[model samples]
Target: MSSARNSYDVVVVGGGHNGLVAAAYLAGAGLSTLVLERLARPGGADLVSPLPGAVVTDLGLDLPRGSRNPACGDLASDLVRAVGPTLLQPLPLERDVRAQVDPDTWRDFVSTPLGVTLEARYADDAERGRVAAEALTGTFASLHDESLAANRGLLYRLLGGTASTRGVAELLTQAAAGAGAELVTSAGVSSIRGGDDGAEVSWHDGMSQHTVGARFVLSNVAPWVLQILMGGDEDPATKPEGAQLRIDLHLDRLPRLRSGADPEAAFAAGIVVGSGYAELASAYDEAAAGRMPSVLPGRLQGRGDTLTYLGTHTPARLFADDPQGAKDLAVARALATIDTQLAEPIADRVVHLEARTPQDIEHDLAMPGGHRFHGDLEWPWAPNRARLDTPAQQWGVQTDVGSVLVCGSGSRRGGGISGLGGHSAAHAVLASR
Candidate 1:
């Protein structure tokens, strides 16, 4: 292959929604921008499940105002009121963000495991589990885990408000293209050379390799991944791994629940399949032991002909020696668990089934452990406490390299469907210019 040295004002490493969002805003702001994507198409994890409002006003696009999807949680009306407007806003995950929240509400959410909080609020395990589904979605923690990751995950999920049934990747892809950002598909970035001057990005398109130079680089991949690409050491401590198993099914029709509830209602509320607090805890414990969980804890979102199952407690490559076997066991457990609540085997309704493991996510999307948010979600308010102290800190995105910035789900004010990280990163770069 010949040496290719194209350049742009800004080069974005990943073409997920956040990348596209940053590209859209950057290109719209008159900075020549190019987005290089590894996947055949963009959209990152397909787990956003919500839309961000900043896209409309800031991007100069009159996109959706509210989700066509239903209000996902019953807690907003009942349990949340009991907690005194706790779920009304995003959970204060960082010590600094806590300033906007009532100190009592923050403590209650952070200190108590979601299951314990639910037990104190509701006596019926069935009702409690239904509410608990939000907290447990995409999380691996058990009801007994002291960290209350469920509480934090739930608070973030609730802040989502409403999302598109189809997700936001395509909408963002179109927006970025419309704004004049150059998007290249099937281009996987292999290395990044960043220093005091501008940087050069090297990538391969299977048959040939290419390099592009840029005055600045904005990353939408995991922060650790960005570091490694720039020749930094891989830190096992901060590197993220994921436990969520996302199974998408195309069914002939929605299965009838053993409880005889309307499929539409259950799907709208997001179905809690085959497990409650104790069962979920047991599954988590079993998986943590590096063995297959007997009972899989998963949530279901479906329409008439399709469903998505997001399972917990199934970590990335659970059986390291037999990775494929581990994924198979996880899938079988997910199907069996779904059948537990169904009058008939869910297999009968399936026209097709696609189960994605953490390994697949890592290999395909370049996420460290296929973690949807890049890593464990954390809280940070001040620049002094975060990973970086550059102007990018204003929006919470960080990277050690002065010319490279992060704008992925891992960024602050951030994660999943919201373009807030991208919006902030764009501002930082534009401000520097």
Candidate 2:
């Protein structure tokens, strides 16, 4: 272990896409910015593996090619055009195939390429309306039969959008280099103490503890970790009011579908696999118990033999301090759902089945709720305010932090590979100077 201390005008923790983006802009502005990451490499969760045959297997969703939000999409396009080819390439949207097994008879499976399959299980329009409401709100609430039926249009529109995957690290690296940011990997921040003059950051590697003084500190790690790093359980300055939980499952075998069906198409198409709110609630509870929940319809995409399953698990309470057990349960439930949904047994076919529990996500990326999105965008939450520049804080490269500004997914219009958090954070940092 080596102990060394370095100085910088600004220091960003965690090397996920958002952090890299922040570093890029700060460096571009000649702010002497430094990015610190705990991973051996700097991609964070977006890291890719070098498989045989000049191919790369992404542990998470493939690199995003476009954005779902129109405004974010336009901004991403501008960033790509300005950054050039090294950052990203256009990849066609791929698809996934999904199927469901009768719980009473596990061997009998009904499979389809359409991402979501609806059953005639709803009793009335109120129940249907309830389903629609939850989908739009992204919350776990019960709805009347009429409510479910009334919200079909909104549900279809939300699920029908094209989804893309991209190498977020690559995008940020190019953006950082193009913008002239300095990124440091394998450096873990230990503490941050703010004063009337400026903020002081203490960090450590295998060998020694080092500190850097900055004008401001925008913690990219979850609100809880921020407390821990500061050597306390509470930090009035860094604690967050709300958070969300998410899980990602990487499966081995490609989900089998009916003969002649486009597996990719079937899988890539998004669907609502589970029934109404009751099923969803039960699934979430099962996940909390570490039991695999029933399958919720979701989209799938493949790069080669590997397939990635992306969807939401049952919602549960997420405390900033302790989340590992919940995350493990979430993974178990996800696996169970996959086992129940795939037409054929996938145990043998799984090359690498891993679940990134919310806790694991927090440990890996230092973000709260293990949520990939910076903030929640469900209904009752205004759309324009859904972006990374909310009054509460900014997730992008912009926002007022004096010399210190935020640039992670949690800042403003949060989450995904769109780089809005970074772009906006960068703009804020530049504007401040």
Candidate 3:
């Protein structure tokens, strides 16, 4: 057993984005706070850093197209307060993502069998297929979360929408340090013991075992990780399954689109590929059954001028039905799929290409099952569950354990790259004081 050291007002476990955010706020409020990170850095999984040997400066990419979290405003506001107005800029309200599919096929899918008349603005088959899929799978409803639902007026005022600086963790760490918070990297917590009075955290810093006491303990790890630390049951239901494949492609130049639209304009918009709604649903079902999808659905976006990243959740061809192999193959397959949708050969535009498998994501980001949302996303309004106001249990920050809080993506308001989970956890700790 490690001996307890001097007590602090708060001791945060994990130095990811959420943990750093909480540390900054807690220290700002004059609380003596200390942040312990397992990794050498503090960004957690949300940070988008440049790949080695890559020349591009900006590495942080936007969330998948069509993904909107209501907590975006809150996170942006907090970040602006921590950094400065100049470090952040407003994101556009315009659609950042665009689906690329055969328009004629889409038109036919939506219209009569003879394809007599058009019903939508889409080219042809793609729109009809999407509409049909949406109708069958309730994809629209599934995409929107009721709990973290966005308020249009408030969202409009959030710096007119914003973009994060290159390195989000670095910014937050600097802000927290400025606020007098102590950040100890390469420190892994062994276990934590807390009660109604306070919390004690035991960790190893590679040199020796050290124990610290605090009025409150905030965890920035996945819930399952936390459960293991506290000797609790690791429920299988909470485990998240990630189907998305994250890819980074350094292209010589943007590929010519089949639509014949301006390259700049097309690059600015997001890219989506799939047969339609039915294909997406089927791919999802296959992935859910521990198999790769036959269709290989994907989303593509151009980051900066040189780097174009394409991510696909569905794999058209799996090597032996293995998820890992499928993820490994996704980048090449995604490029090939995009090639079919483009007027030019995309494979030839490649400069440097890198791929991150779901397993890589799980290990690199330290996310369980590689879920960006931390655990399975809970409906904002879970039926029959007591919904607490913001900054409480219902918000997914506060825990049943006394003064033990969660400040990561697993938190209720957490998902995507929004820092709301950390901000909410910090506010809750502050309120208690």
lDDT of 1 by residue, 326-368 (tens): 7788888899999988999999999999888888878878888
Global lDDT of each model?
A: 0.73, 0.46, 0.57
> What lDDT does model 3 reach?
0.57
Q: Deviation in angstroms for 192 in model 3?
A: 1.6
User: TM-score of predicted model 2?
Assistant: 0.61
**Cα lDDT of model 3 by residue, 174-243, tens digit:** 7788888898888889898888679889889888988889999988888888887777766766666554
TM-score list, all predictions: 0.86, 0.61, 0.69
RMSD of each: 4.1, 12.0, 10.5
After TM-score superposition, the amount by which residue 207's alpha carbon in candidate 2 deviates from its true location, in angstroms, is 0.3
Q: Model 1 Cα RMSD, Å? A: 4.1
Which has the better lDDT: candidate 1, or candidate 2? 1
Q: Candidate 1, 298: how far from true, in Å?
A: 1.1
Model 3: residues with Cα > 4 Å off, grouped in runs: 1-5, 47-166, 233-238, 305-324, 381-391
In lDDT terms, which candidate is top?
Answer: 1
CA displacement after TM-score superposition, residue 25 of candidate 1 (Å): 0.9
Q: What is the lDDT of residue 193 in candidate 1?
A: 95
lDDT value, residue 186 of candidate 3: 85
